[model samples]
Target: MADDLRVDRMTEKQAREELARLAELLGEANAAYHRDDAPVMSDAEYDRLRQRNAAIEAAFPALKRADSPSEQVGAAPAEGFGKISHSERMLSLGNAFEADEVREFDARVRRYLNLGPDAALDYTAEPKIDGLSLSLRYEEGRFVQAATRGDGQVGENVTANARTIGDIPDRIEGAPDILEVRGEVYMSHADFEALNARQAERGDKTFANPRNAAAGSLRQLDAEITRARPLRFFAYAWGALSEPLAETQMGAIERLSELGFVTNDLTRLCDGAEEMLAHYETIEQMRATLGYDIDGVVYKVNALALQARLGYRSTTPRWAIAHKFPAELAWTRLEAIDIQVGRTGALSPVARLSPVTVGGVVVSNATLHNEDYIAGRAASGEAIRGGKDIRVGDWVQVYRAGDVIPKIADVDLERRPEDAEPYRFPETCPECGSEAVREEGDAVRRCTGGLICPAQAVEKLRHFVSRAAFDIEGLGAKQVEQFFADGWIAEPADIFTLESRFGSGMKQLKNREGWGEKSAENLFAAIEARREVALSRLLYSLGIRHLGEVAAQDLARHYQSWEALVEAVDLARPAAQAHRAGEEAAEAERAAAAAEGRGARVSEARARARSERDVPEDAQAAWDDLVAVDGIGPVLALSLSEALANPEERAAIDRLVGKLARIVPPEARAEDSPVAGKTVVFTGTLEKMTRDEAKARAEALGAKVSGSVSSKTDLVVAGPGAGSKAKKARDLGIEMIDEDAWLALIGDA
Candidate 1:
């Protein structure tokens, strides 16, 4: 059934069947895991099935049923416990399986905030304990009630059971009048083993895992029973607050610690995605030695204001994500190698492995990344295989985490077959017979056939209507494929004309097999709704190389209008070409002069190209302005400019642009404040406002607030506890101001 649920390539009928099967399996699993405290399925298995269900639904949107398991969290509150309704919802964080996804999460927040690529976004990374989520409500700094995160919106009333936990304070002082602290309650491994041993001695049932033991102990009907168990709590977040706790996430955690609530000591402030991932790896390495269970590392936007601006999605916050560690690893035989073509024509290799269970999830396929990965070499030319390359018929270690695709970890040369030969990657796309070439400094082998390649065309079309694109309600990947196969739509521009062409004809979409009258109408209406899209979405929909969501937003913010962006790209293209040609000609002249022993002439030619004043003023300025946009560095700028420069690409874009009603520009921040665009850093303990408040106020006043002091730092606000950053600012001769000075500068003194 799991094998049959590869819904990415499944037909509509197959998707319907798989969704129905998944719903049934997941419904029972939820009951067993949440209600009965006896899980019939592993966490890995549950996550995989849920992922498959979501994929199937995404492909066949019309077939999505309301009772879908993907819409659910934990099971409804257990029968015995009283239910409590939360004022503010307790949502879960979306999972990131790989380092790139974590980086994407950070970039996404920056894009939403319209920040420069180089702008620092501080993050609080902490251990994601594998325990039941508990929300404790306090009134006037006194603990009033506590509840479990039963189904996000409502939870079981475990206040009586919660009081027994020693880590939870009966009352907190110097806190907001109305505060609701949310955190995890778990039983340590030692405590769990001891409790189980005691239960065995008393001829009672024992728990399977620490998480289960903790949940069962907390949800017990007898309060005394829960009081006897060693259940601990770690406060990390909050719900409804009458007054703000702290300005930043880390500050709030610190305040919680001061109020006598236990917080994870491993929590630290991280600067960027790389630092966050480094901390994640550190936590993963120490996971086995930790006294309690933690499945992953959770990263949240440190700035409370930023977190507020990047608000909640349907069931998760957009500003935070959890990076789950690999759940399990298993050795399996590499059955074969397969090549898959992406929307961008990149040919990716996949490893087909014999079915094996890793983390209780059956994996028959794993991503080989690219050709270099298969040959035991890193993309950066580093050795990875330790003298044992992966090959067909070789035993390979496969690892799985969260719902991400399995990956090949290592190869067992001891079990390799004698007759196996080195695997050769295809020089042409398997879907279409086209020449595949790996670009310089790139690991991927891409098809050069462009639109002629069916794989690339279908994938691009599918992407055009994906959630992050046009997001037509009833038309999904499967629908897009169906329409493409029927020749109803060939390009994005064709979508806008769909109704006029086929809305009332004999070839109308309603007459299609899978589509009904309502669904067809819904799809057409959705398409029409997106006729006027945001400039950022339009740029992202183009799917240009290296121009991701973040880059598109940066470009959109820089060029406020669609016409401005198109004109700029058109103008930048020629300038870039001229600049590149000039550099090449200069290099050639330098080489020729050096060959002839004319050292002075060679130096002069090099200087002409290198000097700012020697180049065409307009061309140089255009290039400079293009790269000046935050996040749009030289490489990305070149790709964007060239993509717009291509005649065919330009023609298609023009057609698409003509069809749209208008491109909405990003909202501009107020720039009347004196501190607008000034880079300011605050250090030490701020007295007038919380660190979060100060950052938010500075940002509101149009200042670019930085977390650290650097040479580029314009001003430093040193508080009473000023430290190294203040010293650095002083050393660099940067203006040092106090809180009062900052207020005076902002004209609030």
Candidate 2:
């Protein structure tokens, strides 16, 4: 938790700064987990950061940014899948972290209903399955569609994949003609283990947890891949219904079970708050023995009438609350502190701890986050761990909650060594001996050594060859590390020259300690196989911060050719530079006009200067065109421009490109496609495809995907939750279509 950033004591300036940091942190976390399926932080850490953001926003509402994570839902749908807008929004639940909080939830619900202190309330309590949320839609009692809970309002259309899950009833008689059953798609413990074993046998990727396994399986583009996985589902709620299934929540669950849906057997009817807590405890106790994972218990007001009366708050329903279990903690010795450099050169401090068990996982390391965390101070200078500094040889409490990375909770002063001193973070990169600088407003201290830092270089090289990137066989993490250490490979381009340099030499790689003749040949063949790669893969392998797989694909589709993309980047450098210079000059002119006591004329002068100093038409067009592409905003554009402009980086990229046989552009969109050559912008919540996926699909059909609506936009795909973009499109007289219409236009309907 950002417990150290005391919201109540924060100044407006501090609150604003903290809010921005929290927004970026949480937003990245959401994207990593939801879109990339590679989470950098634990759910607990994410929740804590979210809670901190909420606290800061509450304390300084006037300073809240428009894109505050508090206003957002899940990560935007990734590209490649068709989107599905939900008939009824899949809302998340409010969390109660303790029994007292759970009691307070009950009290709040009772107060909302105007119930007296002695009044009793009935609730339905069940385990909150730790799995991917799914909504199954049935038309005329026959399953017709299934979707993920993307951003609550819109999800990915995974109907074909959902059909493979045995627990889902393809046809349900005696149910509403139009029904949407909402629950979780999960992998049981046994199934997860078996699946992992199979993956290992096949030398494929293994899942970190059952939840991720289930989600990855269900989201497979190829339904056959999803069908090969063992997946199950449970019915806990209903979305749209032609008729009411029952009058109460418990009754509805029973009806669902009767309709061939698998409902949790541990679900119980609680007479009051005490019974609900009891059931929560019961579930918590049985969590270990259960076949699947569950992080908490969900308690809902049993009466459907009461639920309707209670209604929802901004994000979650007031009638229902999730009582989350406390994080598991264990005492361990603080062995040492180590700073690790990430791809972006951020120096993260890790606590090297004596091995300890927390929540069935053995953890020997914990995250200290940054200098402030190590110093036990919040950004606002508030003390965490009661001002106790974690020291080497100290017995510290480490905790893990909901599959999050282990973190130090507190230090036991009683067990601290007398000779222990306060740990000092390094001022230089340990690997390169270069200055490590912490920029203003940033929690992380980055290495100024840049690519020269071996730590950063190795990390980036590892990322370049990661499974999602090059996926070069025989060149895994260990191999990458070994080659980098031995000076055999220092960058991506070096891999292509490996065989030519050492294949037939007397000191060939075949004569290395771990390499045999056959293994060396296989490695060279793997490198050769990847010499002719796709433009998207080549761009993604560069490891530019914030340029993910989805963004790379978007760029590939937009530019169509590797040469065109590089030329555009080269053009964008001067264009962006000119734009910045013009903006600065305009600001200066405005200031000079104000100083000259020109009141109303100051605005006029500013406008004139802005227009006169405007970038050249070609330059402006290049910059505007770059930003106009869907998912390619100013931040990413800046990174790409800077990377391509830097001499060393540009040379590296050029070398790599020169070595490649060819960079295959994305497949051209069909000439006969309805949306071909049209400019389309997707706004609000998309039901059929995620915004990214929608953009991809449009681009696939030879349509130019724009992020915002303009007069030039030929069509606007507005979904259920569309807001200002839709209004702008309407005002501009742009043709509008729903997600269904867009899907039909793409011939996917």
Candidate 3:
């Protein structure tokens, strides 16, 4: 322990400099890993540096800082993500890179919890998928939004794309109104290959691996694109919730799964180190077949109550450890080639590699990507660039990419027989007899079959009722696919249209071979419940290109009527002609004078107009007027008016809204309001307040009340000992004002 840490004895100046350097290094590594699943440093190298930094902070406890590199997680949330004050701060976990470290971590957890000598501290272990972490927000029984873990304080909104995943339920059954579930959005090896295959066909660039594919897809500028990708999510832990959940980690996971969130079935609860290690072994063994990429297994204290009691050390929870898997290599033969059609109508080819083992998991197949990829492979499945063609009966080298997928590395040309020939790909769809056409500048081929392909149809149906989309329960991806395969379902409306042979559509639904009465009833109820959703959701569910949650929201607020929205969607006139046809400020002013018999400022005329383009002369006046609102901007205004100009969009919106519920925000959106810029830290007891009250007050006052005090904190309101928070504020030279001071500053009320 002594040698592992050696920094306390240093001068404060040296400590500060060391801390700064550590911050930079960790920040870069975190960004590289989170923003791009590409780690800048080896796990060991990162662990060594982290340990050194922790030691330094421990040695010089007085020099310890709140925003120190050792305490921070990733880079401060990137701008643009909605900032959320976690009910419980989102902390980083302690990493154990070796068996010894794992043992030490085990020791520490027991020591902190005061466990008996023979006490069994079983841990639940799961493969930690190497992907971006996200916080999913559910309000009033609906999946409302999702955000990235920006800086523990803020997160970027990726809710639009998150809506696409079928595993994530938009509305969970038997859950509190407000829930903040945490999960990892990842791509399976199969899905990743299929995605890249499609990309290749389109001549678009491909990601290096599944992790990159998952990260890049989720972070897309357009949520519609994200919706198109076959990303998956598995909820592990949680952040803030309107209410408390089960007492144990496994219990929480079980509860999540029951509530409709997808959970990793591989998770296990071990009773001790031996059992934990065994569980880890089991997980490592299933790595390749697991589909998604997992760099390591995470062992966390099972009991939620126990976890809270163990508390945290600095920024990391003391009750968890990440045990990584060792990397390995093997070789397999290339066999049949198959193409799978996706819900988005994209076609992909999969290589059936002969069986082998990598990192304990058996590898049976790898993604060949596209025609270009196949042409680049040797007859022995090795790269033929200046090299051979990938053919049947050829042995190909396979290696672990993050210890999850068995990726093709090269081919064993020396072992190849003269009988192997180039594997021929199909020129038409395997599922539907549609001509597979390769669009110009594409690497992948498309089954031009559209809605006729069974695979695509089922996939699309599953997407329609996905947790992130309409969140229609009872009709899950599997059930939808099943019904589609059974010929009981077809279009999106067929799900609702399926009549029950029995009573209330339940008995009949239940009378069906696969569905029980209760299950059928429950599903019918859920589907019926969603018959009327919000205009934005209905628009998004239509699966239109270049249209997403944000755009839908904007359109919804812009028109406020379905008739208006559909009218805009169908606009056929050229934008330039419409732009010139709209009313101008000058004409509006003259009209106002003529109409009222007395003319005022151009502002007066503009104020009377609902939109700038309402008048035929000088529309800029009204445009400027709309831009004056807090949330409305020039870009949004232009898009709203231009889109509204189309009659088709407006008409569709009208019809859709007729059957949907109005979405009213909790409150009006706040822009450059009072709470926008300031950081406030509340501490200790308040004579007339609760923690929630204080937080609300600060937020209402246009201030960000952070969980911890740091140099960034502008005001620290202390009531009593305030302990670490107050002291940290003082040490950092931040202003320390008492409760009364805060009240006086905000207002007497």
Candidate 4:
């Protein structure tokens, strides 16, 4: 695993960038796992990413993105099936990787409920199945509908496909008039192996694991295909109910069993966290013998009344948590190491290994993270793997939990070949022969070739036309690669000029291989349709670092037009440069002071520089305005300003903008709402709701939620324990209100 940034030492800028990267990576992972039924990364890696994201958010709460991974349950439903709107949202469970975390979870629950330390709390522990989540709805004793857990609120209707599963009863007796049963749709190990053998015999594609097979089988478009496959369902939860099922979690599972549902037999009721951990250990020991895949053990508060009081976070239940198991390990021989350049010009190292199976998946390639990882040191100079550097032709231990991508866990130096030598990382990009430079705080070395590098150019073009960008109908990744290879398109602007350049004549697109008259015409039509796009999409399509979908939307809402945004960037460039210079000077002064044992002068130097810096008032105002745009921070603003200041980048953007018909601004704000168009700051602990809930509510009411109290702030909501921010609000004379007053204001709005 890669060495993660320490939450305590991470700056707000780094936090914002890390959050953006996690959002994109986790979004893709969710789509692959929930919607496509083929996970791209392992379960441990996914859990690690989520944990890192949560830690970062906790450290810098105001930097959370609107589309944060912490608030997402699952990916949106795939296209082929009909969509079903779930009556009650199917939320995800929080995870615990260690015994202490489990104990902390119990303590948190007790704290939230204001119970004494010796309060009696019972929890039901059960194995968390590694399979697809399905919800079966019954109306008046008859199973009326079945759907997959897709993006929580909405799912794909799989009624016909679900009915074929033998474990799911068609009707039930002694059940509520309206009961929505939720459970896992899975395939046993024996069934999965047998199914794979049949698939191989028929020369069809084999599954990677039992979970994938179960998901693939249950989501089949043809009901007959689903019926031919072996699938099972375990009932453990419910969504909507007309009446109470039971008084406790254990009683509810028994009710589900009596209603003709197949419930897992390993379910047990535990007294507290310690008992829960014991049950988890028992389940872990029985995992291989259980005949089904279970990734972790889930513990839910037993009392229904306590659960009702606990309620939920935005995407997870507060009354339950899954204590996940560790990764599975195997040894493999490292063949070679390769560096691949990404869209952002990052040169990432990958390890090619001899085939080995770990956690039921065959592994041949693993991420080396960065050059520092290969050198056996973290970015902060901490020794890892006992300072054992990785070399080619060495034996390495690989681990995988549930992710498709496995990682190297350790190296066996004794098994290394005598001729093996320390690997040398390239200082130049292999593709473009350009110098690769690693920035001071950055972990990866990036190519300096920019658009001149073929790899970066193709990747940028691909991103420009990605699903969330222009999304031209016939211009997929393969098309982009082919066009770039033929020198037909080299940049985003070149995409908009395709028809005019190759619609006819000897260089025509129709003349190309695998191209027909209709297809070529359709491609041109698709490109034409994207001539007009939303402002946020256009900004995101530029592939700016730290500028994600949410950030782009925030920028769009603030600037409203391309011209306005460009002008602001131009005006703010000088002020951004001055700020950078001041920071650099302060650092230099501190270093000099430390070397001379004159620590007292360090503060004076920094204060003098801040008080004497020469920056135009207009430019400073422009910089302040840009940074005040809710999610936009100094780091992101500087990146954007520098991009526009670059000659080549500016020209490319200009050319692309020239071809656009119109750039639509964001929707108008709700003028009637009291908080609409106002910049609001939240401070201290919110008693009525969580901080995230308050931020969401404010944004929904058309108000901008700033992280800190500023002169532009129109309102500040201060709760108990508010300190610096509350005083600042009072000093600035911003309208200060309590949590109840805030609730009243929004309620009346």
Error of 2 at 388 (Å): 28
State the displacement of the C-alpha of residue 315, model 2, in Å, after optimal TM-score superposition: 1.3
Clashing pairs in 1: 247-692
Give the residue spans of candidate 1 off by over 4 A.
1-327, 401-405, 505-507, 578-615, 671-749
Better of 3 and 4 by TM-score: 4
Deviation in Å, model 3, residue 349 alpha carbon: 23
What lDDT score goes with residue 393 in model 2?
86
Q: Write the per-residue lDDT of candidate 3 for residues 1-749, one digit (tens) a residue.
A: 12222464566787777776676677777777665555665555566778777788777777666666677776555444455555556676777666777777777788888886479776898878766788888888788888877666666777887888887887777887788899888877777778989998786998766666887888787888988999888899888777787878998898988888888888988886767777776666555456666767899999888888988876788788788654465455677777788764567777786444455344677777777676774433566544555667766667767665656667667768798887677888889988888754346677777667777777767777776468886667777777887787776756655654334645445667766877766777787678766655665565443455556555555656565544443342233234433334445566667788885666554544434344433344444444443454544445456544546544543444454445432223244554456898888888878876887556545566688887788888899747557757766888888888777776733
The candidate that wins on TM-score is 4
Against the unseen true structure, what C-alpha lDDT does each candidate score?
0.82, 0.83, 0.68, 0.87
Supply every candidate's count of residue pairs whose N, Cα or C atoms clash at under 3 angstroms. 1, 8, 57, 6
- Stretches > 4 Å off in candidate 2: 1-3, 329-517, 520-749
Q: Kindly indicate the candidate among 1 and 4 with the higher TM-score.
A: 4
lDDT (tens digit, per residue) of candidate 1 on 511-554: 77767777777777888889889888898888788888758767
Find the candidate with the highest lDDT and give its number. 4
lDDT by residue (tens digit), candidate 2, 1-749: 23374788887887887888788878888887767667666666677888888888887878889888877777778888899998788888878888989889889889999997688789999998878888999999899999888888888889999999999988988888898999998888778879989998777998877878888999899999999999999889999999999999999999999999999999999987899999987776455457677778999999999999999876788899988765476566788998899877888999887554355344668999899888888876899999988888888877874456888889879768999999898989887888999854467888877778889889989999997689899999888999999899988999999988884752657778878888988899999999989888888999887798879988998999899988887776766665545555656666677688665455655664565465576666788899888899876887788778878878888899999998889887676788887988888787656676777677778788888777789999888767557767866788998988777777751
Q: 1 or 4, which is superior by lDDT?
A: 4
Specify the poorest-scoring 10-residue window by lDDT in model 4: 354-363
Which 10-residue span in candidate 1 carries the lowest summed lDDT? 606-615
TM-score of candidate 1 on Cα atoms, chains taken together = 0.48
Off by over 4 Å in 4: 1-327, 357-361, 400-405, 504-508, 511-514, 587-612, 671-749
Better of 1 and 2 by TM-score: 2
